[model samples]
Target: MEQFTEVFLEFINSWGYFAVSFLMALENACIPIPSELILGFGGYLIFIGKMSFSGALFWGMVGGLVGSLFAYYVGKYGGRPFVDQYGKYFLMKKSHVDSAQHWFDTYGISAVFFSRMLPVIRTFISLPAGFAGVNLYKFVFYTILGSLPWTALILYIGMALGENWQVLRTIGHEVSIVFIILMVIVVGILYFRRKQKR
Candidate 1:
């Protein structure tokens, strides 16, 4: 982990905000780039006076929008049959894809906005939004709104924590893990309860 952190910091330090933004955009598009690390390091850069807060936020948002659009285009052009056929290879379930499509249908552009704030789900949400035929302009607008604040928050935490920035990174990872676990437990309990009621 330390080696990975060192390599990441070196890359970010050398490449600066552009690298951070590009990686962040890729991360959002399910590239496994670790958004927390990028944002945290970016924040640390800001803390050390290497970058500006607004600059970080701007690039982060741009990266997010670009990455999301990549996924959206994939879904739009690939269609449901393509996803149903190949998504499993990517560890994606048909039901999960279907659910996201349903949510997009029901909530419209707001689904894009809200999903961007979510952790793991945010990565895949844009595809469904596109598949559901959300307006392109609305999609971009809400995606920006949803993503900018999320990016800003992570950056702010890093800046505020300063030398203790690692704590924020640890907290982000732990919280995401805990949240996923709790969600699984809740789903399991609800499923069994529904079976009993039936």
Candidate 2:
């Protein structure tokens, strides 16, 4: 993991703001790329005079918007058939899909806005919005509103932490991995227990 981190740091350091923006966008698009790492390391770079903070934030926001829109469209046009067929591959269940759809129906665009702050939930939230046929304009507006702050917050954290930013990056990565593992375990346990009950 340390070696991989070093390699990633080297790559980003060499590539500069463009790499940060690309990684941020890919991460937002449900690609499992850690936005925190990009932002934090970018911040450290700013501290070291390797990159500009404003440039980092600007590109990060652009990447986030692009990636999120990709997910939104995938969910919207692909429909439940795609979800039902491929969701399990992504650790999603039919009930989870149904629940997200229900949430979108009940909460509307607000759900999209709020879901942006959640960890794992944020990745999948767009699907329900798409499946529910939420207005594209409203979806984009809410998504950007929710996502920009998230992108900015992480990037700022990166900028602020500077040389010691790796501490936060490590913590964030561990937390994300643990969260994903726990979610899978909990979901699997619930699924089997529910099957037994039924």
Number of the top TM-score candidate: 1
Residue 152 C-alpha lDDT in model 1: 85
Q: Write the per-residue lDDT of candidate 2 for residues 114-195, one digit (tens) a residue.
A: 6665665566678877777889889889888777766666666666777678777657745445644665598799999999
**Top candidate by lDDT:** 1
Model 2 segments more than 4 A misplaced: 1-4, 87-106, 170-198
Residue 81 of model 1 has an lDDT of 84
Task: Report the C-alpha lDDT of model 1 over 48-147, residue by residue, as the tens digit.
Answer: 9999999988898888888999878878888788878887766666666666677677877788876665556677788887677778998889888778
- Candidate 1 global lDDT: 0.78
Q: How many angstroms is residue 65 displaced in model 1 relative to the true structure, after the best TM-score fit?
A: 0.7
Q: What residue pairs clash in candidate 1, if any at all?
A: none
TM-score of every prediction relative to native: 0.76, 0.73
